[model samples]
Target: MANSPQAKKRARQNERRFAVNKARRSRIRTFLRKVEEAIASGDQAAAAAAVTEAQPELMRGVTKGVFHKNTAARKMSRFAARVKAMGS
Candidate 1:
């Protein structure tokens, strides 16, 4: 369907971008799952560490346009609150 050369190039670029974004999303999810698992296990220290590690990864996702800024912020806020609540 891409008759024009430019369009064909764009389609190819889109495929590459899609793969890169997919990998980034998968990596981000892996970090998120680590935090969730740590939190579920009720290991405060591990949960705290996991969240700390995930925070940067989430922000990186936003910077790379994989996630919206507020989405990452909300996730970080919720995770932080939960980790803090575990203190008591």
Candidate 2:
């Protein structure tokens, strides 16, 4: 349906961007899942390490426009708190 050349170009660009963003989102989710699994296993040390690894990925998602700043901050805060509480 992109009759104009500009529109066709934009559609192509969107497809490429969509693929990149999807990969980024999947990578972030994988990191988050690792943290969740570590937490569920009740291994505080492993959870902490996983959280440490995930923090930057989440922030990177925010910087890359995949996630909102506050959303990433909130996730980090909650995960950190949970990891800390696991030690107690």
Candidate 3:
């Protein structure tokens, strides 16, 4: 219960930020899903393209504070490795 006005305002702000962050996270997941599907299909070209498209989105999430830098970096590294392995 937010009794103080300031607390109430903060609660409101948190709710708004939560919504925004949730949407952003969902969008990032969608991009990741595209990459996963491309990879699973065993289409090297599509997987490569998906990774290219997702790279910037993942970094954008990191820049926007939606995801931690290391988390995004690790995901990108793994995805890149998987894509590379698919080629060879």
Candidate 4:
């Protein structure tokens, strides 16, 4: 479908970017999962620690164009709220 050389190169770049973004998304999810598990287990310290670790990774995904800024912010906000509520 990419008849032009430029188009072909763009397609290749898209494929590479897609793979990288997918990996980033998966890594972010893993971090989120750690937070979730820590929260579910009712370990306030672990949940807080996981949130600390995940916030940066989520923000990194935003900076790297893997996730939208607001999306990451909302997630972090909600997760932090949940963690906070768990404490009180």
TM-score of each: 0.97, 0.97, 0.98, 0.97
lDDT of each: 0.98, 0.96, 0.96, 0.96
For candidate 4, give the lDDT: 0.96
Clash count of each predicted structure: 0, 0, 0, 0
Highest lDDT against the true fold, candidate: 1
Error of 1 at 1 (Å): 1.9
lDDT of 4 at 40: 98
Clashing pairs in 2: none
What's the best-to-worst order under lDDT? 1, 4, 3, 2
Runs of candidate 4 exceeding 4 Å displacement: none
- Candidate 2 residue-wise lDDT at 37: 96
Tell me the tens digit of each residue's lDDT in model 2 across 21-79: 99999999999999999999999999999999999999999999999999999998999
lDDT tens readout by residue for model 4, 22-60: 999999999999999999999999999999999999999
Question: Using alpha carbons, what is the TM-score of model 3?
Answer: 0.98
Q: How far is candidate 1 from the true structure (C-alpha RMSD, Å)?
A: 0.6
**C-alpha-based local distance difference test score of model 2:** 0.96
Off by over 4 Å in 2: none
Span of 10 residues, lowest total lDDT, candidate 1: 1-10
